[model samples]
Target: MEKPTRLALLKEIAEFLNEETETYDMMQGALKFLIDGSDFTTGWIFFIDNEGNHGLVSDTNLPGALVKNNCQYMQEGTCWCVQAYSNEKLTKASNIINCSRINLATKAHYQETDGITHHATVPLRSGREQFGLLNVATPYTKSYSEEDLELLESVAFQIGSAIKRIWLTDQEKEAARINERNRLARDLHDSVNQMLFSVKLTAHAAKAMSKEEMSKNAFNTIETTSQQAVNEMRALIWQLKPIGLEHGLINALSSYSEMMKLNLNVQVDGLINVPSLIEENVYRILQEAINNVKKHAHTDEIYLKLSQQQNYLNIEFEDNGSGFNINHNTEHVSHGLNNMRQRVKMINGKINIQSSYEQGTKINLIIPIKVD
Candidate 1:
């Protein structure tokens, strides 16, 4: 590549990063720009997450078969470049170490001969912290020069800075979400919750003192509704903090059921404490399940059974209510069921729902849990 062209490519990549607010989008744009500017046929970016796990972040300009094979190899196997980069031995752009994914790709395709699979890698870094590796591969005839290496290094720096900026933006958004939740929690506790409490107390006294039948019935209704609202507000406040979830999953599910005005029966056998992350997912799944029941079940009673058998945790939520046909595509079947399914899958769990006209509904979830 010429001097002017290299500078133009770098500027274009920077502009592309400027337009992107998401990390993955920036990565895809950067990879496309790098491959388009150079003689490289295809390229991919490998990023190390905050947990120090190495994985492919973005890829471009590769055939479907080649991309699949390379992605699988990279996911399952190790790379010398990434290992050396982690150890601080491979910071700058270098052609000294080759790529194992490229070697695998060559073996899969006979056309990729001995020298055609070679690639150059540079560390994507900002200051002293390296985020990932940028890889560009071309055939033997179009081998990279020193200038190409310098240009890739400069591109890596720009991408690294963009990645950091995207990360910071995510952190800010999460902080904002937490702050808003706290504000809502405080407002509910200070105003609505207190008023509900007062109403409940006044209604209770009025119910006891009233002699007329109509006045006593009115007071009784007021007391019951006010109590229900207060309970719901309390649950909402706890959801913002998720305080009791750290204690146990069963307790959290029971409390959530009470808030929904459901007569919940909890049965547990051989249960053990799981990680907080898994517990959080479990709580979310249960909450969604209860909401689905309240919205569609038309019943105020639920049976919940949780058991730890073998290496998995099994939970069953059953309700005897008006059920819909499962054969036809029903609108109610998609939203809550899909949300529950996604929550289960996020924690490597499985969920099954069985429902039919007037037969009620039963949902069973089997989640693999690690016991300490």
Candidate 2:
């Protein structure tokens, strides 16, 4: 490519990346632009995190037959370039190392094209953190020169910066969402919830003073509706605010149980301080479980046990109630249970539910804790 054309291609890639909303889309755009404008026949990118875990984030024009196998490898395979980058051995663009994924793909296809047998990779980094690796493959046998290396390194730098920007933007959006939720919670609790409570109290007094049977019944209905409304509004506020978790997870669960009129027995055996992310997830999972019991358990008492044992946090919730079978394929199954499972999985936790006809239900969850 000529000087003007090369410059224009780089500029176009940057502009397209800037317009992308998601990191995956940005990476796909970058790879596609590189293959079309440069001499590269195929391209792919991989992201590595602090845990030495690497996975493919984007790729360009993979063969239909190889897509499934390639994706599996992308998630499970790690190349020499990635290892070198992680070990701080390969920082600049280089063609000295061969990609393991490409080698595997070539071997799998006996009639492989000679155009894209190997690839060169550059580490994408921002400051001290390695964001990922950018790989470009060509058919020509000629080795990549210093100029090619420099150009690839420049492209890597741009990609790293874009990834960082996307992260920051997502953080800002989340913060804004939390702030808005807090504001709404405060307004609802202070205004609507308070009024509902007052209305219930007034109805109770009217019911007591009324002598006519019809009037007393009407007052009783008013009081019941107002109480239900107040309870629902308060629950909504908790969902929006979640400030109760700051006091402690145990306390939050106790308070929520009281609000739902369920007799809750809580047992704590060990230290409870954990990361906020873990704490929030545990709280939500328990909340969903408690809710499921309230709606379907047909029992008034719930027993909860929380403990930390050997680098893992264990939680148990048991209730003696009308039990039902768990059908995984049924759409009518409790969404609450499904949501609880999803939350546990997000934190890399394990959950088990035991239930049978007239046998009651037991929920056991275990989550790994990061020890400092």
Candidate 3:
């Protein structure tokens, strides 16, 4: 590529990155664009999380051997570039003489490599934070010139900066959501919740003083309805702000279960210390689980256990209720399950639910803890 062409491509990539808001879409699009516009015929990007686990997030024009079995080889094991990256040795664009994945394909007699044997590897980073690696290859290319390496480094920098920008934006959005929830919770408590309380008090007073039986009955009904409304409004407020969570997750959950009129048996085997985000998510998920039991379980008691083993936190909920088929495919059940799954996924966790008719229901959650 010419100097002017390289500069133009970089400008285009910057503009493209600015226009993209989603991380995966931006990465996939950028990889395709880079390969299409440059001399490289294949490219891929890996994303390394805080715990040093890497995953292939984007790729383009992968050869048949690598693409076989849905790119099992690339996704499964570490390669030379990845090892160099983890060791902090691959800081800039440089030649990788022996790509491990490619070599594996060659040794296995997979001849669909498209003549690719080596690739240029660059660490994708912004300042002090390292994201992952970017590797690009062309057929029969053994080494990259200084200019070529420089161009790759520039593109990698662009990608790293874009990744950081998107991450910060997501953080800002989550902060905004939490702020909005707090505001709404406050408004409901001060207005609707207080009004319902007042209505309940007035009805109870009227019922106590009523002379006519009909009037007494009317007052009693009003009192009951207002009380139910107050309880529901309180539950909504708890979901929004989780008032007692600052004290501890167990305390908050116990308080919530009491409010919901469910008997909860708790057993904990390990110390409960985690980030606030994880606590909040767990609290929310358990709230839903308890609600499900109350509405469908035909039982009023729940068995809860929590334990920490190694770097994982495990939680289990069991109830001897009239459980339903897991594959029932009901709209409400599907939505609730999907919501729980999404919350767990956000924290890189896993959830499993088991239930059958005439039997009981059990839910298990496993969340990985990151240690610094």
Q: Each candidate's lDDT (Cα)?
A: 0.76, 0.77, 0.84
Residues 205-287, candidate 1, lDDT per residue (tens digit)? 99999999999999999999999999888878977745466568877777777767888888888756666656766777788
On residues 1-372, what C-alpha lDDT tens digit does candidate 2 reach at each position? Answer: 443366787898888878876777888888888788877767788877544567677988654323655466566767787788888898789885565765676677635545565668898877775777898877754477776777788788888888777766764564576678879998998899999999999999999999999999999999999999997887799888675777999988888888889989999997877777678678878888777778887998999999998778999999998878875323434677877876665565678888876777899998878611
Q: Tens digit of lDDT per residue, candidate 3, span 312-331?
A: 88999999999889978468
**Structural similarity to truth (TM-score) of each candidate:** 0.63, 0.70, 0.73
TM-score between model 2 and native: 0.70
In terms of lDDT, the poorest run of 10 residues in model 1 is 62-71
Model 3 Cα shift for residue 56 (angstroms) = 1.5
Q: How accurate is candidate 1 locally (lDDT)?
A: 0.76
* Stretches > 4 Å off in candidate 2: 1-4, 64-66, 112-114, 140-142, 253-372
lDDT comparing candidate 2 with the true structure: 0.77
Best by TM-score: 3
Off by over 4 Å in 3: 1-4, 105-111, 211-217, 256-372
Residue pairs in clash, model 2: none
